[model samples]
Target: MYEMNVEDRGKLTSNRTFLVKNITKTMNVVDKLMEDGTITDDLKQDIEAKLTDNDKNRKLLDIIPRRGPKAFKAFLNALVKTDNAFSAEQLSPGAGAIYKVSMTSSEKGMVSPEEEKPQNQHSEIILPKKWPTEQDFVKDFIVKTCSHSEKGKLQSDNYYKMRSKPRGRVLMFNNFVAVAHKVEEEDGLWKEKLQMRDGTEKDEQSLRRLFEQLHFDVEVKKDRKVEQMRSDIAEEKAHRFHKDADCFILVFLSHGSTEGIYGTDGNVLTTDEVKSSLNNKNFGSMTNKPKLIFIQACCADTYDKGANVADNMAKDMSDARKSMSALNLNDPKLENVDEADSKVEKSPSDADMFIANATTQDNVSFRNTKFGSWFIQALVYIFRNYACQTDLLDMLTLVNKLVSEGRASDRDRNIAVAVSVFESTLRHKLHFFP
Candidate 1:
């Protein structure tokens, strides 16, 4: 049945090319043998001879060490756990077949006969309804017959379980309160604050400590323009990752509005712009990879009004809306629009974007007089405590819960919050420490 046509066989002469071609062919052949039935010693010897014909093939053989009958059976059992075992089309589809094997160890005992079951079952117990319990009498004989017919016998039911492994690449991007803007305007004379009352050497130092512990390649930039921020993003995107990179994280702690963050000149830079700058042609492609962004910025539309006379009034959504409307009227010219909409308009469905906004559109993002930004503090705390033990989404959920429950003065009561998860299933829900 195995006839090689003269024209197709004539092309391969070089050892390297032949090695590659035959290795592929051998994989297909082995796949067919596995689907049809067990692989015998004679079949293994034949394949080994064909595979070892070239030096490159011989080296590949060493890399994928040849397994004996028991090992091969165990390997087959292992594959069932990882792949759709029953989906492979049987090579001898026309022939009558019996005694289907379960690939995974966990499912092995479930498929066994009544005699194979543990004797400690209760008197009221009935057999599983899938197959007839009367058929159990012939199972041992059938299994023994198959074992004698095939060279390889099935190993013990239990096999080693495959645990999750670590991916070695680390991603780190942190932005401190880097905006340098003119706050006081008197007769066109601009008064600048090099650092805001909340900003100082200690903020950046704390961030460096946290990120260093996380093993991030930290690079601190001061007072960057919007375009300079884009350039930094481009440079960071150039950091190469292996094919198995588990997760990526980017942290921005700056002065910002509902729609966008601020640059050095007080010009607004949108979140979509930041994300696009990292994904452009200048930056290396990161399609289908998990890209996490944590923003700690002031999303407040206007300065807070003094506490209401009735401090303990039960505020509903309507009250919240009224407060938001009043705030908007106070800052009509300064209200930022939907910056993320433009990107969505361009392409409705490009996944791998998860943005963690610091607050709801109406509320203000918080900054501490002593401790750095409130959102940043919550983030650092959660990442330090939970990032290693739980999934990123779960960890962030915990952060949001903690931040909302945190105590604050009436003047500074707006706590950190977040929303929006695009293509949730496609996300890599990994815990870096786990």
Candidate 2:
């Protein structure tokens, strides 16, 4: 039936330009599919129902740029809206159904085929009171994904329960390794400056308070060399190795770079080197456990307010893909070169590591004399309020919300947190016991 419809449609359109336009229109639907992350059996069926022929399908497939926020959104939209309203098999035991009413300007008509008429009986459509900015878009996207997930509540619970790990211990490392030295090496030059700014203490104090609230064993190390700090971490890891630890938390309050951390002696050591040293055979005894590392430091120098788009990494990937395409490279070479360029670290220390940088990739990690880094302050603040009762991501989302919608310098203090749990598949209620 699809083939016959395509054949008839093709006969009616002899104009190549019109055929090309038709093909482009069809491809737009495919692009939507790729955007929304919904490439499934039902997705294919819905798409097939929209297009009439193989030629149109081929044309549509060619226009998709491989990756983008739009494409990803389209992919996901296809997944939930196609077939039986929502995929029943994809829902978890306790999951409820999601029915989203996406509205378009009737005055302008629908922009895409995936956009269906709003089922709301009201004739006049009321636009959303506020247009969603990038941050709003990200939070909404995450919320939608979670709502659709099978183990949604449990996953959410595990994130919220930061201090409830029965098998793993939570260790909080507070205290910025102060930086004190007189310009490299000056013969007996003692510059006793307050290296860890007042801001640093606020973050440290808050972290300490959070743990104190949770009744977890907290360790505070101030004014330590690289080796000494590493040794302390090692000892703690070893102590917790045989003992039942629920989780391991390491918060570094100091000056940092993309490579590693800065010590009080003005010496820099790679975070990777420090973390690697804490592996199972080394200082880290809690192998395959959830390890969280929050680094309140700088990553890049570009702090353009306008550049705060959806996903910087995804944008970079898209740019790289375009660059590769423009180079006119062959299939094999493209695959190899692209693969090498896009390579990422698989695992960090066999422990679930969460690295939350103080700022975004190209933004500055702010420092206030009283509040510390905006990212850290926001993190601790949100965790203090919600960590025990809500999901970790939810808490982080709140942090993001607070930061994004906050003041001038503070707003720019964008944070980027990445986490990897060691697959325990368990949930806990994270709360301050005290």
Q: Cα deviation in Å at residue 393, candidate 2?
A: 2.7
Model 1: how far is 419 from its true place, Å?
10
lDDT tens digits, residue span 1-434, model 1? 23233322232222234234223234333443455444454655555655333443343333222333333233223223223121111111111112234333443322334323222221222323311122221111111111121212112122111111323222332334444345667687766534352532334544544454443434566666677777776666766652344345565656666556666656656766665553312233455555556665555444433344455533321222111111000011212245654644321123444567656554555455444544455555555434443445765675556445333333344411222111232334443431
**In candidate 1, how many Å is residue 202 off?**
4.8
Q: Which 10-residue window of candidate 2 scores lowest in summed lDDT?
A: 323-332
Error of 2 at 149 (Å): 19
Candidate 2 lDDT at 258 equals: 47
Candidate 1 displacement at residue 318 in angstroms: 28
For model 1, the stretches where C-alpha displacement exceeds 4 angstroms are 1-203, 241-245, 279-284, 303-349, 410-426
The whole-model C-alpha lDDT of candidate 1 against the native structure comes to 0.40
Assess each prediction's global lDDT (C-alpha) against the native.
Answer: 0.40, 0.41
Off by over 4 Å in 2: 1-177, 180-196, 240-242, 279-284, 300-351, 406-434
